[model samples]
Each structure stands twice: as C-alpha cells, then as structure tokens.
Target: MDGQICCMVMRVNLDCNSCCRKMRRNILNMKEIEKHLIEKQQNRVSVCGRFKPADVAIKLRKKMNRRVEILEIEELPVHYEAEQEAPIVNHYKYY
Candidate 1:
C-alpha cells in the first residue's frame, strides 16, 4: 500500500429515495480500521462520530456515475507550508 492516500471530493446526482437509503445504510456498515489507527496515534481516542471525508467519496462513487474531482490535497509532514509574512510598505518610497 502506498503511504500517500488520495482524498477525493465528488458531487453526484442521486435521483431516487431508495438509492439514498441504501447509500446511508452502506455508509453505516463500512468500516476503516486504518483510519482509526491513524487517529489513535494523533491523541484521538474515539474514531466514531468523526468526519470521514474519504468514506463519503467512496459512497458517492458507489451511488453516482459522474466523475469525482480531487480537491485540496495534502501529503504528510514533509509537504506542509507556512503562510509568508506580509511585506512592510513604505508610503514615502512610492512618492
């Protein structure tokens, strides 16, 4: 398994009530032990009741036939970037 996990976001057309119900039930039944493990190391005691964006992506793919968009992706600690400090402006220099 690759260390990098893809985080996908999708907007789908779910037109039927039955499909919605099944999707909800399916989501509830699905479990990700690896995500729980990651959270456990980060001082997160309970994996339940937490937002699972990746799981949502899976559900969307299962229910809809549209293409999913990949948005706001970030790798682990190595790729993190801090905000740059604002530049100091001198009004006298422009005049």
Candidate 2:
C-alpha cells in the first residue's frame, strides 16, 4: 500500500492504564503511523498511516498478547498541491 493513506479502527482490551500506556508506546514506535487516538472507554484504537490494516492488527495482537478485532478500515484521500508555473516577461532594449 505504498502512497496510500488509510485509517484502521480496532477493538482492543484496554483494561487498565498500563495497557493503554503499552499500546501507546507501541503505536508511537511505528514509523508509518501519522497519528493515533485511543478511546479507553470504548476499548478502541484508531490509527491513521500508510501501512496495511492487517499488518497493524497482527502486530498489535503479538505485542499486546490480546485479541484485536478489526472494526473498520477506511482509505483516506491524499491531498497534493499543484505546482505553479512562473510567468514569463519580455524585456526590450532601446538605443
């Protein structure tokens, strides 16, 4: 999924503050992630980045030693600015 951005929401068992902290640390270490949000009350983790959804789920499961359910996966549009061309001007010399 190169050059593609996506958001993945997963349900994880965040029973305690330590669990949330561990999850936060692991997510922070992932270089591909642009940002992340954790809802402790909902026991959900939302990650936005350029990585595959399944890969993240697997990594979280392995690292947390907990069951992670993929709740949703959404492909986000990438916005790029168009390059502007420089205007040309004619110069005249009079003798």
Candidate 3:
C-alpha cells in the first residue's frame, strides 16, 4: 500500500430523515466533534468514513428485539449526485 492514506467524509444513514436530524444534532452537541465540524464546514477538515455495522446492529437488536445488519456507510448523502450537480457552488465555497 502507498504511504499516504485515503480519506472520505463520514456519513450514516438512519431509517428516516428525523433520525438523520437527530444524529446531526447529537454530533453538533459533542465538544470534540463540534470543533471538527467547524473545520469541515470550511472544507479544511480531513477525515475518513466509518460504518460500525456490528455496533449499529447491536443497538437495534437491543432496542427493537430484532436482528439488524448495516451493509455499508456512505460518505456523501444519498442524494449527493444531485447535490453535486447543483449550480450553487457559492454556498459550498463559503462552507
């Protein structure tokens, strides 16, 4: 492998948009992550994507009393392709 490491944005898809909002809020509430988010907003942050399938499945199993398995985590939003095609480059530049 090359010495340089590859990185991608971290994203977790929940069952619904409410879950996504809740998770985003939770992430924003974290002191450590808050700082990183600030940098991320500026597009100056470096990070790698992670998807803890086992952990998520365990949580679901405990809550729903049913088995769950996470297939993968997406770095960008599910609608990333459409967003990327947006003409609003200015908004991202400021972010």
lDDT by residue (tens digit), candidate 2, 1-95: 65778889999999999999999999999998988999999999999889999998999999999999999998866552112235667698878
Q: Look at candidate 3 and give me any clashing residue pairs.
A: 41-95
Clashing pairs for model 2 are none
Clash count for each candidate, listed in order shown: 0, 0, 1
Instruction: Report the lDDT tens digits of candidate 3 across residue range 1-95.
Output: 12222232333335555554554455454332212221323222222223333443354345434333333333444454456467853545543
User: Candidate 1 regions off by >4 Å?
Assistant: 1-9, 33-95
Q: How many clashing residue pairs are found in candidate 1?
A: 0
Task: Give the number of the best model, judged by TM-score.
Answer: 2
Q: Cα RMSD (Å) per model?
A: 14.0, 9.2, 12.4
Whole-model lDDT values for every prediction: 0.39, 0.89, 0.37
**Better candidate by TM-score, 2 or 3:** 2
Return the TM-score for candidate 1, rounded to 2 decimals.
Answer: 0.31
- Among residues 3 or more apart in sequence or in different chains, the pairs in candidate 1 whose N, CA or C atoms overlap within 3 Å are none
Q: How far is 30's C-alpha from truth in model 2 (Å)? A: 0.6
